[model samples]
Target: MAIRGALRELSVQLSLLNRQVGARLELKDVDLDCLDLINAHGPLTPSALARRTGLHPATMTGILDRLERGGWISRDRDPSDRRAVRISTRRDRNAELLGLFAGMNTSLEHICAGYEDADLELVADFLGRAAEAGRIAAESLTAE
Candidate 1:
């Protein structure tokens, strides 16, 4: 019960934080989510992105369509797999987006400024383990 309550609180807080950040940057949640995933993972196929993002394939296609129209991302046929398509951030626009995020990044850095290396390491370990547990639980639920 305690853990569930804590998780609920964290979810609420994170959602609020995301909304605040998105509003500040004039971006929709889906756009930010897609950009964040692409920035973190380099290029990926639409299906691969759907799996990674927990979005439906058609929804992912729509997201990609919007992003491409906005000049934020580009898609091309994968060289190694002609049937598969790969998507990547558009270099010029990506740079512009990165520049826009620079201020937010600095603010985040300030928030972490007081953390020691050991404290940071512990936080990372805890979050990684928690994520793994969540993944396993999700897989089990899907299997059932």
Candidate 2:
């Protein structure tokens, strides 16, 4: 119960943070999700992205279309499978994206600076485990 409450609180806080940051930067949730997905999984097909993001394939198409139109991502013929296309982040924006991520990390680190090393480690471990559990839960929900 405590963990669930904590996760809910964290989700709320993160959503608020995202909205604030997004307002300043003009980023939409889909744009951020697409960037995050590509950053974590490298190049992927639209179907693969849909699976990873738990979005409908048609929804993924719209997301990809918007990102492509914005020049944040590009698609190319998959080297190993000419019949399939893969989407990836644009090379020119790599540094800019990395900088933005680093800045967010720094902000988070500063917010966590009051914690002791062991406390921080424990929190990190818990969050990692919880993330994996959440992913499983999401997959199961989608399956149903």
Candidate 3:
């Protein structure tokens, strides 16, 4: 219950931050999330993206279209498989997008600097487990 409460607070804060970033970039929440995915672990195929995001094909299409139209991302054919299309962010604006969260990232880094190495490792493990749990929950919801 305690961890759940903490995660709930974190989610609220992240959503608020996401909303602010989205408004500043003239993007919807899902669009921003797509960008985050691309920036984090993307250059992913459309099908992979849809599965990762748990978005329907049609809805993912709209988000991709909007992001592409806004010049935030680009699509390309996978070199190994020409038939497969992969999505990536526009390199020119990559720095600008990352800049949005630079302050928060820096602050988090500064906070981490105070933690002992073992404590930091524990925190990282906890976060990893929590994220996996989130993924599992999302998958279960989608499966239903």
Candidate 4:
């Protein structure tokens, strides 16, 4: 029960942090989410992105359009499938995006410094599994 409460708090805090960062960049939360997805696993086709995000195809189109208009992403022909288009974050904007989160990253590093190697590994492993569980839950909910 304690762990569940802590995890919920952490999730809410992280979402709020992302929302603040998104506001600074003149981006909506969903746009930031899609941008993060593209940055993490980019060069994905539009349909693939739509699936991963659980966004309707039409809504995904609007999000892609906004990102492209903001110079945050680019749409290009897929090399393997000339008929389809791929979406990717613009390389030039990487530095700018990183700069926005530099403070948070630095703070996290400081917090991590207090943990021993073994403890950090345990925490990392737990977090990885937790993230996977959350992803599966989201997928199930979307499917339903």
- Tell me the deviation in Å of residue 58 in model 3: 0.8
Runs in model 3 with CA error above 4 Å? none
- Per-residue lDDT tens digits of candidate 1, residues 1-144? 886788789778767766765666566787778877887796988888877767778988888887888777889889998998899988776666667568767887997788998999887897789878886886666456
RMSD of each: 3.2, 2.5, 1.3, 0.9
lDDT of each: 0.78, 0.82, 0.92, 0.93
**What C-alpha root-mean-square deviation, in Å, does candidate 2 show against the real structure?**
2.5
Better of 1 and 3 by lDDT: 3
44-124 per-residue lDDT for model 3 (tens digits): 988899999999999999999999999999999999999999999888987777788898899999999999999999989
For residue 106, what is the lDDT in candidate 1? 88
Q: All candidates' TM-scores?
A: 0.74, 0.81, 0.93, 0.96
Residue 93 of model 1: what lDDT? 67
Model 3 worst lDDT run, 10 consecutive residues: 94-103
- The backbone clash count of each candidate, in order, is 0, 0, 0, 0
Candidate 3: C-alpha RMSD to true structure equals 1.3
Error of 1 at 31 (Å): 2.9
How far residue 107's Cα lies from its native spot in candidate 3, in Å, is 1.7
Model 1 scores worst on lDDT over the 10 consecutive residues at 18-27
Per-residue error at 37 for model 1, in Å?
1.3
Order of candidates by TM-score, top first?
4, 3, 2, 1
Clashes of 1: 0
